[model samples]
Target: MIIVALDPPQNVDVEKWIKIRYDELKEYVQGFKIGVPAIIRVGLEGLSKIFKDYSGLLIADLKLADIGDVMALTASIVGDYGFNAVIAHAFVGYSQAVDELSKTCEKKGLKLILVVSMSHRGSEEFIDKHLESFVEIAKRVGSWGLVAPATRPLIIKRVRELIGSEVKILSPGIGVQGAEPGTAICYGADYEIVGRAITHSENVKQSALKIIENQKQRVAKCRG
Candidate 1:
């Protein structure tokens, strides 16, 4: 499962980025990730314009970090903006926040993907600091999925154990970060979110195909 991160900074040629990647953005990727840059460059209008022709899951990575009511409201607005899913900051908010966001998303049939961990250099300190507690919150809140680094083996196992196959995991840090899709799956990641690895490649299509090919090989190996 692929989740393409559309997170090129503002200076990047958004139109070119979209156009070049258009042909390759097929069912191979389960979702399109709209992070800070994409959201900023192409607001609701841009999103509407893109999704008008492109039909895949849209993930609004707002990473919302507010109270229960605010989180619910933000998620509702994002849903209204035609997003299939939105991200929430699991650490900052309370369980009630998750409940509220989940309820709102459920009403609109949208998904709330909780950011249990991010893929950055200093993430370990922040995540390891409150790993167990946050995992409990994630399980209790009942969001659609959790985002974490694909490289972290133990945390992924713990998360799966807590959720017991109910909650999905969207793991990033593949390719460019040195954790391939096969490696992530072997560690139990449900979906792979890739960005620069494909977007910045010399041949986007071939790059995507290679990653997909690698993923297939890995999945087969894991099953065997």
Candidate 2:
């Protein structure tokens, strides 16, 4: 799925911006992703008003790393508003409390995607240090997916090997972040989290379409 990260234009009417972007790009992409910062900027009430008519998967990138109750409550708010999934942090060691959060997410029916590694510079060492334990948390929590950085193809490959096919892998860092579009999927990603690559392009619809085309071309090349 091509998830368009919903970012509110700081100077414009955020509700209008969202509507325009979604309406324009929905046909080319599968879903939309709104991070915690964006949600906070517009508030859930504002977000609900704008997304009520959206038919695709709505992902809330909570990336929560707090205690269990806080995570549960945050997820309650996200699920209540109709988000299909939410991302969480698994860097902390597993325990009964985290298991409780897992139960809460399952009860809410929101898919839990754990962030394994980030895209920007300087995150490698930290993620590498904690990678093994994070995978353990992911397995214990019944996570639906895992976040892998497209910028690092081997990391995706390693994650695919370690976690296998049961866990869906979502990758970011395509286009503007310098990772080639579709290449992540070649390595092991199931979806690419594209943002500025499309959003900042001169033409949003065309940019979105090109992302899909790029992926398809990659697939064709691999098969050939």
Candidate 3:
């Protein structure tokens, strides 16, 4: 399950790459990740046009961190705009905004993926320490999925253990960030969220295909 993190800086590139990737690499990956950067540059409505017909999973990586009601409204907008799933932060705790956001997504038919840990440096200092709390919150909210950083193998294993078969673990921080392919899922990830490695490659399709192949072999091994 490879999700292309489509994050081109310019609006023109965003649209261009989206069509190309969705057309060429749709079979190679399970879905596509549309982050805030792309949404901001192109505006939700503008981006919506490109994704409106894209029948695959359109995950909005908004990382929504706000009051439950506010976050729910924001997610509702994304859902209205055609996004089926959304990524949000767990740092906000599990009661008000975070909890409400989950319920809102349920009512709207939007899948929620909570961010428990990050791939970048320095994030581990805080997120790593609170891994248990984050996983617990993610479970309590009935998240459809959870975000884990591939760069941290130990943490990913811990996360998988805590959550078990409750939710899908979507991991990022691969390729350019240095976490090797065929590795994260072995540790626990159900899906991989990759960006620059494929989008920035001279041959985007090939890079994506390689990831798809790696994921297949890894999954087979895990099953065996």
Candidate 4:
């Protein structure tokens, strides 16, 4: 599945920009990821209006990393805003924060996606060292998915091995971050979170379609 991250330029009208992109690529992609930029610009209500007609997964990339109560409250609000899934940091530990977030997500019927590792080089300094702990937390909490970086396909491969086939993996850092279109999927990611590349393209639909095609070919080759 291809999940588009709606990270448009600051100057553009975020709501309209997102609506246009949603309309263009909604059919080709499986879901849309709304990050801080768009959330700050138009707020949750605007997002609801934009995606009212969208039936696919709507993920709120809040990256929630606060205490249990704080994160739970924030996720409650996200669910109220019509988001079907949320992303939080697993480094927050297994007891209070992640456990609470998982419970709240279950109650709210929202998919809890934990960020196991990041795509940037700096992630190697800290997050990479605790991959096992992160995956364990996801399992303990029964998380719906985990976020790994597509830029590091080996990380995706290793994560798949650790988590196995039950929980899903969503990878970022595709286009602008330099990972090939379907590299993560071939390695085991269930979905690729792409921003910039398709959102910033002159022809959004074509870019999305091309990405889907590339993912299919790569997965076929990997299996064959």
- TM-score for all models, in order of appearance: 0.91, 0.94, 0.94, 0.98
Candidate maximizing lDDT: 4
lDDT for predicted candidate 4 compared with the true structure: 0.93
lDDT of 3 by residue, 85-178 (tens): 9999999998897899999999999999999999988877887789899999998999999898899877789999999986899989889999
lDDT of 2: 0.82
RMSD of each: 1.9, 1.5, 1.6, 0.8
Local distance difference test, candidate 3: 0.86
Predicted structure 4, TM vs. truth:
0.98
Of the two candidates 2 and 4, the one with more favorable lDDT, higher being better, is: 4
Tens-place lDDT per residue, model 4, 35-138, is 98789889999998888878899999999999998999999998998999999999999788899989999999999999999999999999999999999999
Candidate 2 residue-wise lDDT, 67-186, digit = tens:
788888888888898787888878755674456668888999888888888887776768766776787789888889888899998888888888889898898898888988788888
- Candidate 2, residue 130: how far the Cα is off, in Å: 1.8
Candidate 2 regions off by >4 Å?
none
Model 4 residue 63 CA deviation (Å) reads 0.5
**Candidate 4 Cα misplacement greater than 4 A, ranges:** none
Candidate 1 C-alpha lDDT tens digits along 1-224: 78888767457778557655755776567778888667777677666666766667788888888878898887787777778888888887555677777788889878878877767768787766676677777777677888877767566766677666778888888888878776666667788888889888888778888888899898899889
Clash counts for the predictions, in order? 0, 0, 1, 0
- 3 or 4: which has the higher TM-score? 4
The order by descending TM-score is 4, 2, 3, 1
